[model samples]
Target: MRPSLSAFKIRANMKPILITGYVNPDLDGTAGMIGYAEFLSKTGKNTVAGVIGEPHEEAKYILDRFNIPYPLLLANANDYDEIVLVDASDLNGLEGKIDPNKIIEIIDHRQAHETDKFPNAKAQIEMVGAAATLIAEKFIKNNLEISKNAAILIYGAIISNTLNFKGSVTTDRDKAAAEWLNKTARLPENFWQELFSAKSDLTGEKLAERIEGDFAWFVLGDKNVGIAQIEIIGADKLISERGEEIIKILDKIKDEMQLDYIFQNTIELLDCKNYLVANDEKTKKLLEKILDIHFVGISAVRPNLIMRKQIIPLLKVELEKN
Candidate 1:
């Protein structure tokens, strides 16, 4: 049974319920927390959005562009009576700031993690491409008033996560949510193109930040995998200039972190293509065969694959077999 928050209502004046995104929140995470917190507030639960870590450049840009207030940085959720997790539910993503037991609700679109920890919390996990899509749907379904800023954030998240609906994991729900949000948001026609360009503004100076911005760790087939993605406009140029250096960095990370595989993919947003880099040839060959795209040097050129959401599952299945 889907858990209901009706029984968990706030009595009189109390501390506002806390809602937070995972550490190092991306656009989807930021948007999801904002939208869901707004929804809960309207439902008679005072809620405040929080972030476990600083917003990434893309999320910060979108929030600033829309004039949406930034979520408060949360040191911990120990003081809050209830907590809602958006975009991510893993304990590692929380960085041990908030106890998993304190989470009262989880609204995520990613694969379930730490499921046992939140056994009593209401979980709304959908297989959609983006968590923002699920939250946007809540606004529409509950007939909640979506402020223009909220709509814009949700729309931006959907666009960013789905790569304008070109990503493999995008569903009809995501498209529908985008249409609904765009109706009131009326975002500029060039918003997506401009945002994509902005996201690809990584230069040599921001190389380390670019690598760690979207990094995640996963356990696949008894081996810990550290995966990072770099979304850029000049994938080929970047690779040609610093491919060796990037590989060396990945090698060091793999060894120091005891990661069996450290994979990095540079996605060219302009052409909607990707090239990959990894610490080892075995990992590269596996990705090539699984993604059905050969590598050009260290980068996988235009593999027609986009979104780590699509790639991770494929890797999991293959890794299990190995």
Candidate 2:
């Protein structure tokens, strides 16, 4: 049953509810921050959508389409009734904008405080692909009407984070949540397809520079190891045109970053196989190589796209072997 609305509702005189994103708000964080803000406002509190990082283009479209107001900047932290942290990993960085005692809730989809970092948080760490999916569940569980804009934002977040549900970390829960919400939001299929097709620079880069930008952290032994996601579309063409450059830079990355291992991954979306450029024969034979089925485009595991999908489980497998 839902709680009583009377206690939750604020008089018009109350401070605007601030809805802020993670330190660097990506599509997931941006969508979750705003979508959750919309839900909170429907419960009768004035809301302000905040961002430590700016929203991406698609998210900006949703915000504009929904007519959601841009939130006031956090010049100083002492501003709102309760500080809501969406995709926020660190509370200290946002110190001046929120009182340590005033934070009421934290919501995210990533692994929460494996190191016992945030002692003061009442956070939702559900290990799903996207935080937007969780906020959608909260609305449905509470029986709130989801706005059209909310749907698009969350859906975009899911699609981006899950890499069109192809990322290994994606689960049935993530699939179900995105499926349910997208029905009402009613965005065109081609729209998303075209939107996602905008390729980032996976090709022309040094491995060291590439890994820093595209990595997600996972526990490897005592240290938190970072695995990078490098996606290039055509296997043969990429090899012919840029393979030498890739190998050179990747070797450079191995030395520069001191990586335990690097998986230079390529995905031809048309063909499902994942090709990896590894540092050595030992690293090459690591994951998926054990299965050893090479068809037109075949591999048992596609572990290079998203580390959450590929690296985390691979770490578990590697740890057991050693």
lDDT of each: 0.82, 0.61
Model 2 lDDT, residue 290, Cα: 41
lDDT of 1 by residue, 1-322 (tens): 7555663453433778788878878989988888888898899888999887688899899888767789897666777767888998778788788877778888888763555677658888889988999999988998877988889988999988888888777899999999999998999877889889888776775787778768887887787888889877788898888888888877777878898878887777777788877757888888888788776667776557477666777788888896
Error of 2 at 168 (Å): 4.9
State the lDDT at 301 in candidate 1.
66
> What TM-score, over all chains together, does every model reach?
0.91, 0.67
Instruction: Please give, for residues 84-118, the per-residue lDDT of candidate 2 as tens digits.
Output: 77866554335345565556677876553321454
How far is 124's C-alpha from truth in model 1 (Å)?
1.2
Candidate 2: misplaced stretches above 4 Å? 1-18, 45-47, 54-83, 88-104, 111-115, 166-172, 200-212, 231-240, 243-259, 265-268, 280-310, 316-322
For candidate 1, give the lDDT of residue 202. Answer: 65
Q: In every candidate, how many clashes are there?
A: 2, 3
Question: Worst 10-residue stretch by lDDT in candidate 2?
Answer: 291-300
